[model samples]
Target: MLTSAILAETGHAAPTVPGLASVIPFVILLLCIAILPLIHKTSHWWEHNKNKLIVALSLGLVTIAYYQMRGYGIAHGDHATDPGIRTVLTVLDHAILGEFIPFISLLFSLYVISGGIRVKGDIPAHPITNTVFLAIGGLLASFIGTTGASMLLIRPVLRTNSERKHVVHTVIFFIFIVSNIGGCLLPIGDPPLFLGYLKGVPFLWTFKLWKEWAFCLVVLLVIYYAWDTIAYKKESKQDVTLDETRVTPIGIDGKINFLWLAGVVFVTGTMDPTKPFLGTGWTPFPFLRELLQTAFVGLSLVSTGKGVRAANHFSYTAILEVACLFIGIFICMQAPIEILNLKGASLGVDTPYKFFWATGALSSFLDNAPTYVVFFETANALTHEPGPGILQLLSGHFIREDLLIAISLGAVFMGANTYIGNGPNFMVKSIAEHAKIKMPSFFGYMGYSVCILIPVFCAVMFLFL
Candidate 1:
């Protein structure tokens, strides 16, 4: 049984004892994402069957709803004539209204606004120059989102490295630093941290993580520089004429989009549950922050010139794919979230190390936003914090600060463990693939993470956690 705090935070009443059957849908979805690509080599089966995958996952939603209604009816006498219909509506409302709309809207706005900006240049792709570009991307990701940063910078990086034979490593490292670890220091940086802000964590509290962020950034950058230097040498040996083209100065187009980008950041940063824009008397539908962001997206579309978009080769394919896949992901993820909410307290996670690994392991596969909330609630249960407030305020004395730090680093850093671990990862991959970079398949990419990122994370846990 979940506590009242858990129920209020999760927005779901306690169901019957969640059995193994309850988690099957989530398991099946993960397996399909991981395995289907490996099985169908040389065929577009995975791409073609995306609709089928969504429908299949929806069956899991229906199953969970049926069981939830049955459990509710048994526990508290049958009050409604049709519990099944009511349960379905409740699940749909929570999944779609409570989660999906805000998530997709933010991503859509960032994608559209960033896609409009075009950085035009014929920069030479030297090892040192490439390193600087990635460093800039890491810094940019903390202001704009990982999705926005990746979309904005990937094209220029790709164009710079257009003549290089060994280009895959550069993009992989870009995903590591820019798409994942770089967003650790601010709520506006990553989806998981933004969720923390919405749930009462202060906006600047994440800045305390600068030490961890700097440590990972320095280590990864040094490693990337060495690796890229070696690859560049190999390519140079093969083709001696690669250095004939001189570097050109970079210029910007659609500079107005930067203003809209700042608007997106300001809107997200100002969202506060304590002071709803529409007053507490009215039901908060889209919330003021999201509405403001959607407006910014509309403004960017009309304000940016067509020439800028043409230079950028901007298209809607990446955002559309994210929208389609994430809708089903949010729906199918409810069961796992419910199970975690019910059972997390009993999981023996009393220490910082335990919380770090547990939160990170699940975040490597599940969406990190809800995963952060689950562990946040679990930590809150330990402290018995009276109500929702900033963790800095509420848990300062009662909760272990090291444990909170562990959860924060784990959720943010370990998202690099897989492509699906973070939102920008797949979008970056899709864009790189469209540009003719032969990105590794799902498992192949995990092989890189395990070999490279896992050891670095272990060192972080030892030194920091």
Candidate 2:
């Protein structure tokens, strides 16, 4: 029965229900994330490390059970391999070495390096100044990741607005612009785009999104300036005064991290799986990139002064929280990815608009990196292209360019729709709340995105998609 179920779900003879049972762990994890923090007021259970560990282990065990029952194993395993032990080993290898290690390593490198660079001094949080800050952050986001840019700028933005009462909108807009929409222009800017790059989309392919970037930036910045100006005026009417002494000339500490930052860029740009490390005699290991990034994290740790991290209030809590939750996410997400690979062409997502919304909607909930891969495969399937190369599909006219564009845009942009839409969104919110800036609840944050970001995306659909 188990063998029949697995074979049917894998599209061997005839399709069964595709074993959606595998996705239950993912849904439970997401529900806990969405609800647990909100109810932390009543039940302190969510606040305990033990509870988080229990949830993570529970979901992990479910994933193992699903894979075991399905007779799944490592990528190259044959049918003769032992299913139970091989399944456990494959899940551990994929989850830890393949996904979790690299993911956490890059994030830790960014966090440690960015945390070392303290922006010394506060610029008054006037509407225009705030707007300029966000603009800079958006541009920086394309260079350093959304996570890097968020960690680098959130503290300074908070400090600048320390005198203001109504600042939640500022952080909300920051998530919209810096953490999500700004990442559309480069593979380095977002995980989804980077996944595309790894799949043979040219590194510069995403630069075509400059128009989408400009559109979203212009609209969001204009609205933010107008809204902030009104809020500032209201606060002024309430007799608020800027503390001149609290203001200092803007500069940066731990400038050495910039060299480390450059190193990160170089590593990401040059690390190719198909390419040899040095010569034909030596091939690159799969974990080589993660190892290089981990070394960079070590450099940042030793190079920066303690004062810089202290000033930034740098702690491992945000990254720790992300690491805990995403393990369950990456594990359980395998089922949906498998289903999509087998059956996506039949899902009525043949058009560019459909691809955009479908990919974007799922990217809003699931980890966007894998979501992009799933939809990328789905789009490729529609073409029945001879090769898996994205560039090949484009150059040969095997796939519609508009369809690719829609998938790329959707996977990168709509990650602002909710806290879980992107990794950095929740990190930014957590950092803000840690600093005593009360961020909106998960659903409340969505309310802001619905009002502000959805219309801008609609304009994108009309003009670009």
Candidate 3:
């Protein structure tokens, strides 16, 4: 019998119909793992290690089952009038079809390339050089976005501190300050600000956070410089000679992978569901657009096999692990998202600053994209008008542009509070660890955030925000 008909015959209402189709991937994963050892299929194994594949497949299935059971009740709820099907489908559509699978391959490729491009040569040994780099890095981040600046500069920073024994702290501080905080000055710099931009917040609305960004940068640079100076001085006290033999040019020694990098950014920026791909005016043909995106990404992967592979023998391990773990996370998180969205306004959050902190606090834990949406919804519910704020009277709204700016700044800035808070943050950390610089544990990471970032953020809240 047809699945829907069978369920109906069992006295299930339309609201009780679960999305059984969504479990197909999980089932396929399990079946592949279960029968892999029994059958001597060479193509089935490919280059993948079977034992690891089995473990990963098992984990993935377990995750699917957990989420499925959590969502099962809502799908088969008591009330026939409940929005169960809509809720379940939204979870499957957004978390699985929307996020996990599509971006995983691209993200994996980016991680490999990020690992390959190590900077060489001696940086200027001046005391203020690190500070200068931090300031320039922040400005670069504002324009090209944080990921661009981080990728471009991370190697050079690593190379500069290559000789120092106590330099890991310097790099960690760099990620905390330049890589994340520096994205605050422009809407294009981070995802949250970019979301704000699409939602009618001006590109320059980010300028309102300039004072905060500047304050945080200045403080962080001073701390970094102090740390760098002490490390340099300690090294100078010892008879450390500059390794002129190790000095090489700063550029990657292969065919530039600019096209591939550009494709990665294009996939990330353009695939967002909230944004309309087609505009009112002239547009690319829909079929051609998809074809072009697919071809560009595929060709970029092919180009990686060119002279670039010799320059850096790239492997897809770290990013593959990230892809595997995040698929489960993204899928499982749908349940929490639905529950949160349904009950968001009832949480009793009000006021712009309240939202500013609340959104930021959660953004520090959850992925910043959905966290932004949750608070955006809360702000939407609080006010019945076009925006997410209280209503006003004669000609002006109670919630001014500054208020929106504050909330926006908080969401974007505080995403740096932990490694998981932003996508690039954890990727960078993983890459750093792969390069043999030991990263802190989760709570240990939070210690750095609390010790340094919180004070700077508080100063912003007191002064500008």
Q: How many residue pairs clash in each candidate?
A: 0, 0, 1
lDDT of 3: 0.58
- Who wins the lDDT comparison? 2
Residue 137 C-alpha lDDT in model 1: 86
Whole-model lDDT per candidate = 0.76, 0.78, 0.58
Per-residue alpha-carbon lDDT of candidate 3 for residues 1-465, written as tens digits (9 for 90 to 100): 012222321224533333444444444443342344345674245324444344554655554565545434343233322233443444555666555544444344444444334343565444486677667778877665676566556656665655655656666676776668888877557767766654545456578677778888888888888877877777753324663334555555423455555565554445444445545444333233234445654665555555454333345554554455456556644545555665666787666566777778877765565677667656644544545434332223233454465567667778788766666666566556656776676566778888888888777777764
Query: CA shift at 148, candidate 2, in angstroms?
Result: 1.1
Our model 3 lands, by Cα RMSD against the true structure, at 8.4
lDDT of 2 by residue, 1-465 (tens): 112223211112333334677788888888887787788473477655567767877887888788778754433212322456655555565566566676777777887788889997887788998899899999989889898899999999998888888899999999998998888788889888887776767678889889989999999999999999999877853335564446789999999998888788667756755555434656565666767877888898898999999998998877777777777777777667667756677888888889988998988888777788788877866664454533463224355567788998898888899888888887898788788988887788888988888898889999887
Overall local distance difference test of candidate 2: 0.78
Cα lDDT tens digits, model 1, 240-331, are: 25543645689888889999999998877765434454335543334566788899989998999887887877887777666666666777
Q: Which stretches of candidate 3 lie over 4 Å from their true place?
A: 1-88, 101-120, 124-127, 198-204, 236-239, 243-314, 386-403
What are the models' TM-scores?
0.88, 0.90, 0.72
Q: What TM-score does model 2 achieve against the real structure?
A: 0.90
Predicted model with the maximum TM-score: 2
Q: How many backbone clashes does candidate 2 have?
A: 0
